[model samples]
Target: MKVQAGELLQKINYPSDLKQLKEEDLKQLSQELRQYIIDIVSVNGGHFGASLGVVELTVALHYVLNTPYDQLVWDVGHQAYGHKILTGRRDVFDTNRLFGGISGFPKRSESEYDTFGVGHSSTSISAALGMAVASHYKGETDRQHVAVIGDGSMTAGLAFEALNHAGIENSNLLVILNDNNMAIDPNVGALKEYLTDISTSKHYNRFRDDIAKVLAKISEIGPDAYKLAQKFEKSIKGTLLKRSNFFEALKFRYFGPIDGHDVEHLARVLKDLRDIPGPKLLHCITVKGKGYSLAEKDQTKWHAPGLFDKITGEIKKTVYEKPQPPKYQDVFGHTIIELAEVNPKIMGITPAMPSGSSLNMMMKAMPNRAFDVGIAEQHAVTFSAGLATQGMLPFCNIYSSFMQRAYDQVIHDVAIQNLNVVFCLDRAGIAGADGATHHGAYDLAYMRCIPNMTVSAPMNEEELRNLMYTAQQDNMGPFVIRYPRGNGVMVDWQRPMKAIPVGKGRKVCDGEDVAILSIGTIGNEVVKALNELNAEGYSPAHYDMRFVKPIDEDLLHEVFGKFKKVITVEDGCIQGGMGSAVLEFMADNNYRAQVVRLGIPDTVVEHGEQPELWAECGYNAKSIAQQVRLIGLTRSMQTIAS
Candidate 1:
């Protein structure tokens, strides 16, 4: 008990090392573990609040479970920073989310302790259930499988589907619902309300158990009376304990609404549950940002405070000499409010990212118009479709990676119906720190293939405003506007909103040499490359192909006929993105030109700064210039031969 957490944790490279310590020592371990995460995240700056909240739970799970052998799956890996530190990643913890560093999320390739790779929420229950079933089939009946899911994640349909199937299978799996009542933003919906009722109503559970025992005696006394008594008991309990009432009906042996922060209690409860068979769920109540006072005060901002002072809790911000452009999300946030004020039918909807997508601004301005639909992506998509059916134009703001979860809904409900739902895909490119699991690299490929979808990406903040303004007008079908993470390039972005003609692109810098066609914010790099190429006397014509779906065919024909060498760049995948779009167009038109496609390759990009990742992908300004130089020389050779 007197052992220091810092000292104990230093020796802990694995769960077996953690298990060597006495049970009383876990309290100190949890403290040190919380401080450790705060210390690292203060300067390093990845996910802060979630990891701090789950310190005790992480310590208890690793100490109790035979991890690496017995499976442990974290729902969203935002809470697994501490798990990484304890599991042989202590030295490299400082390198978290840095260029060439380990992934921010739990990756199976990174560690044996991380049983499954997870980034998007609500997947742990399904993955853990699958593992438990696999264990059962393999005759490893006693192998313990656990899935630690957040309360916010439980709102998703996938969680319920897995819970339903797990009940039928009767697998020995433990689902630790880390009921923090939050995800990125504060949780929404009836599930949060129900969980709160369950967490608070301890006496109701005891009373229900006592009453159930008393009611069972009616069957022993008289069979005919017992039938009526069962119906009455079920009906009354359904009305009385509606919260704890649902899980028991799902065939899960429910326990807790217990203090998740209590390390000893958690360890003991987990040990007890380890011996119990069939599908089990332990509801552990916890605070989102528990340890740090400032973090606990403002959970959303504290969730990922960039380079904050751990002691004073003051965030470090760059003292810019000039006015800096606002984040693309902030632009969307303010723009949505402005657009909604003019149009009565305009509404905003985000899955669980009201704050992240800056839709919280709309929520604050028009609470009825903007909605946070929880971590249910599929539900959010269908809900938007429902709104669209009522002549309401819904701006469905979902992160590009998260949009994949609701692809089927987007196709079946919205796209097929030709509903005028606007998809504002925030973080449509490489989302830094969150890694490959979160990179919005495939949205263009997927969205473009859908029949009634118009895909577009803005080069700067001005274009974003204009396109958003244009899409709100009477349109044929679903429209997608994708922009990158971080700040936009334009300092004065809020210009007068004007409608941009669909499927048309404007040439930025004209040249007699190679033609460069770029899409989205990635075109910013092309502009830089063109400027640099001009200084070097290499004139590569620059064109921002605004619309990826109904591509600027007029511009493409002009470029191919005039210049034989073309270079296409995009932030999305090279497979079926803007580059592929250009290739298909050239093939269809029978244009003989040397086309070089530059974009994200068919490889998972690791956690890194955007610049470094962009450079590595060969889409940065410097890399683009190099490619342009090679293209200029290749075309010169072709001209000489002619």
Candidate 2:
């Protein structure tokens, strides 16, 4: 059915509009919403399964809760598409995840209904509790606060910490644990088992209700009876559960292992919970990729379904001119597999990003050696450090942005000990569409500051492979080889990989008029810019300064002497980035040259396409050439003045 403009979704602009919807009408509305999401994502690809899994939950929440006023914070906001569509963004769904369009995740500025901006996982509970506490302080006791967090996210320590704090404070907060039994891949560890026990327990709800009713009856017997009833209820719950009362121990009133797909059931439960309060946790069981058959069968692949034939549920594989080398993550995955194959001491670790980090390949190849430590970035770092002490070459793969969670761990555990752990920092630059929270802009800045840490970024796939080999070989201190997301330069992998010299850079394009010092995956862009400059009757020297840490003094002095005008480009913040390093070096040496820094601005960059981000940051060929030409013209004027 073609989506008609101003039909079912058009009439409903906000949560208030949704409240007018009949309970029976919500089933059709959910269908429309799912189809709309499918239609939008079919063209503009994004997190498909996540949104699909939360379709009924999204509908139920909006139907029951008064949104915008009743704060609903979504942890790792990738699943907030249905929320966005329901809250006045259905018409613009076509432009989802595109440059200058609707974000893939919730943004505070985009909609008032999006109470908290979230991209990183396990933040909803803390944020929701903060809001709930604020509301209490302000004496807005009627306002409801709900946190919708995935089972995957619940694995993070921060969630547990928030639960602990909220429980103690007795904050008026509702935490909805959306358990899909999958976090990118099947969620591992003891928590998954605990959740399974909760979901499958048949008499749990009946027992909980009976206990609550008994407590209510006792409360009617007056103040003395109420105190005795509370003690009896706590003892009974403790004896019946017998397990580590995870949420309740943290002080949250645990409710449900409810059916997430059944919208009516979810609505009834949410409504009941709305009446009762004080740090409540609703555990709703959902299936990842709920509706679609293929997605249901293979949830991991469907997690972020690519452009596919909606009818057939088959992804369309596009063929390139020359079959390119796999992504940097794939190379890392394969490299680790090879290393693990040879050395039994090697262990691989990823923080719930098995697919994204390409650690699945390693996990499959060496099951015992590889681990998907779910959404626990801090834990992953410390875990690797423990492995390091036990004579294991622990290759910890995590997205650069996520590594922010373990900044203290990286410093305290790994760096301080000078452990020989390999930190494979993937997406260490402007990760397009996912936006500011996802962007790996500050990795260089953050990683560079850590003592006994060697930070290296590869210019191409070969260099990335080489760097990985070097990192494994060097049993010195902790080494981090940062690589950007997506395929690297489409280089030939058939060629034998060679190890790059550590803390060294190589000249890519030779010129005399000006020098362009470039870093990371942006080297290709810099090369293109230099080519454009040549076309415009100028020859600009280009150097791919692969390593950010150990300043290449010889290369810096040579480039500074050769060209009076120098421009530094990186896909990171200009402050404390590659450009800043160069500027600091020049200052230390007292070398005065006209320096231009091209990078992501100090402020947060919004969601957009990778190429669009590059263009916006003046890292694209045309933009870089324009800056060079401007500088050249100014130099010519200066020469004439002299």
Candidate 3:
């Protein structure tokens, strides 16, 4: 179905077209742009509330700036849907986040208007500062560089690092702090409190309004009053506001706490700021899900409510006939609570991903025990280590991709010290629609390499529970349990938990011709493959290697002694992953085997559904079955040759 854009939006094919509109028309343009985003996303299914929240600001930035020449970078580019639409991508907007289509986040290759490619949080300030510095070096003095970053992203140390450096550069950089108080969930930390204080200050607001009137009158009076107005403004900022303002200490000229939804005023302010020199910050206070009533009420739930009814505000869901298995995240959420209930030592920690990682359940059930450390992945890891030093078993739940940010902390604070910290890496494989940056593709390889790290992944919810139970036990140093996003194989998942021995694996079935070894939830795919192969009278042995590190040597020995042809499968990268681990074990023990490794290959996998990605990566059930058949065919041909 072709969703028609509004009359104003239809005319705005590019920022150039947007520039042709009257100043008053921008409000209508914002409304149309917001509706267009709603129309496309309601059917197409991508991030929802974030793009909705930044509609007015998106319009204002493009309206004031000479985009493409004047660089603009979006922090955590999920919120750039409006930016994308305005920057000549409105026609193909329906293809957002689909496989082989446009990306969910901004990409440098995709458009010249996208000054910097971004997927992760808190990168905008640094990127925009770099652009600004380059422009300064090249003598492009008129060029403007802007970074639109969320308050949630502001909590990260990287943002502060950029701000600290940007202050000294004397570059034309504008850091627009989009203070919607959200990053998937509500913003937390001292920064959140500080921003709240500034935005809600009655004294500051009154003084700002009074000063604005005086400045307006002074500007009309003449050049001398304008000079006095500038000095007066600086004096007021230094005397009354600077003591309380955090950004001022960092040497940034903080300019706002203004209504971001006001399109005309925002445009005017942005136009004014463009002429001002050095590092400046405009703190525009906006709503996370502005214009949408239901989204405004429950921002988190509507953050990415896939395929919703824009009219009725009803989020769509896949209707299954029978009882379906719970998502791996929900299983973790419930299972952690179960473990924490009995074990007093167990505590939970996540960096700005309470809901995403499902630690919100633990946060609700055991409020004091679970902590949301804002957008500081490094802090979350080290903080978990700190808790571990005091004998508190901390399950530091983080997305596998996001864990890359805390690699140093994981090794230095936890692994090197041999702290008993249980690292539950959620979204532990091809992370679907959010694309490559979000994919949990490297944790298997990364975690296994760390000294004293017990790296493991579960095949199903029951195994996950068992793994969690096992990790919490005494003397288990720096345990790492990773699991994929979405549903596990088992329907009845909440079975009583029991500890399985570490470095152990189990034989799912015994066979004669060939052997198939797998690790983690990818083993479930191997099961499906076996079923298909069996129907066709092909018998292949299967072993589920639960732990990647301290791999089951006994199981490997059993397989090598029986079969010459073997296949290793994992949901992670083949390089340094479970398949590589198995091959290492085989070579170490001096066992010769014809091994065919199947997993994520050495390439960038784009956004798609889980099943589509698995097939594309050649490790799905169908792919596995085909591999087994091909191997069986080759063996028969070799036997005939002999």
Candidate 4:
């Protein structure tokens, strides 16, 4: 349990245990905690940097506040590792983000101290505000509400809305803006610049504190004099920094621009602010990957670096060095830049995921054309639509799961108006370890239902490139190009870009007994299943149904008519996914064939390795093969019955 020679973290079973330690020992505890996280994540592989950056803040907050009863909500839960460790999950910290183990993010189901389950960014303020308001209504004045959010997350409209509401309500709430100048990648937009100005302005913070001291003395003199001094302070704040006045206008008592690394300072600030009335804001300045030098230098790369040597800071090489395939995002990154070179009208946009979606590549190459619009999803879509209206072709890159936030923009701005905005949805399937909130399971269903929207999912990197290429050719309404996370199965994926016919599919392998149809990168798994089935003397016809919208009726007619036994496999939900499309096709044509549908069932998937999750959903290579073999068993049973 103990990490250091003296063993500080080993004794911390909960927040109370952490509180029992000497104030001086807290600094050592923070160091031990950081090392422990690095040691565990070096082997296990989880989100880095954010957790490391918040170690001091986490230790200080737990030490200052009466946690479980007080209510501490972490925005997105990326920085909750230290919180998890100190609050009785240290022994199980090694199981982070693994199947049937503790999650990488904070979970209400996992622990009582979690307070609220969060995955998406910018929800912490809103959630914590609600908790604060609830405590007020219940007459529980002792219960404190704290929302720890990142500077990048603050760019979202949701965070502002929460802050706005909290301000008007005048409730007891403390919002700690973890200003690390980065999210998953480096922070962007005017808000980031505004915060940076505040961070660097030492004279302003010092002068402001001096004014506060004079105001405190003015309060003792007389009530009227104190009010006059407060009014003067507001006028000076308005004149000095417009951004500082912005928070003050919202009725929040703004504090800090303080060193987040100092445990003693943070604890002191937090204890003083605990009694302060109304909505409070603490702007704690910290470096992303604070303790780790390599990570601090290249914060984006180390955001979620896979397995690595803790001491050497080098990525551990695999024993078996196979030919490395480019990650799906890398393909998008390079392809977007390539396409932008040809088309002057083409513009790239990402909602706070410059690095994650690989839009950073384009951003770096053509700074003017590509943009990281911060954590504003709805704004990003509408902004892209605005660009399309001005005769510019906008490629809006958003994670498939995250696109749910901007659904209205897709319907109203793009599809309804018939704009030529291209939606490049990365992480279009299981999304492996991050769990159900991150799964791209609903894009197929949601996108297909929309009118004038061409919903397409690529089977491989080649198709992805071609599809992206085709979407940018003309003002062909709105097009959605979705591919999965991680590397494509193909190694040599830099194929020439070609225009794929909209809503058309091609046969991959020929068969007779049963037909296997698939969509997305999941089709690669189907190919594996078919090859395995072939080895066992079972041949099934396989079609890569690229577009989910048009359903490829010409191909479906041939598939359903040729084979009585048909199976549809997809990486999304079965309710309204590719399987549903096939069923609809059969109903319209009245094709009375025994069709088997395979995909994610009507249940939430747990966080696990992709293969295990795919198997759990009954769509992995082996699972698909088993489903195909069922055709023979079913046919035999029917023959015997007849």
Per-candidate clashes, comma-separated: 0, 0, 0, 0
Candidate that scores best on lDDT: 3
Using TM-score, give the best candidate's number. Answer: 3
- Winner of 1 and 2 under lDDT: 1
> How well is each residue in 111-190 modelled by candidate 3, as lDDT tens digits?
99888888889999999999999999999999999999999999999999999999888999999999988999999998
| Cα lDDT of model 4 by residue, 602-627, tens digit | 89887998898999888999998998
Better of 3 and 4 by lDDT: 3
Model 2 worst lDDT run, 10 consecutive residues: 211-220
In candidate 2, stretches whose alpha carbon ends up further than 4 angstroms from where it belongs are: 5-7, 205-244, 635-642
| Predicted structure 3, TM vs. truth | 0.97
Candidate 2 collision pairs: none
Model 3, residue pairs in steric clash: none
Question: How high a TM-score does candidate 4 get?
Answer: 0.95
Q: Write candidate 1's Cα lDDT for 444-484 as tens digits.
A: 99999999899999999999998999899986479999998
Instruction: Quantify all predictions' global Cα lDDT against the true fold.
Output: 0.88, 0.84, 0.91, 0.88
Query: How do the predictions measure up, each by TM-score?
Result: 0.94, 0.94, 0.97, 0.95
Better of 1 and 2 by TM-score: 2
User: Least accurate stretch of 10 residues (summed lDDT) in model 4?
Assistant: 210-219
Which regions of candidate 3 fall more than 4 Å away from where they truly are? 209-231, 238-243
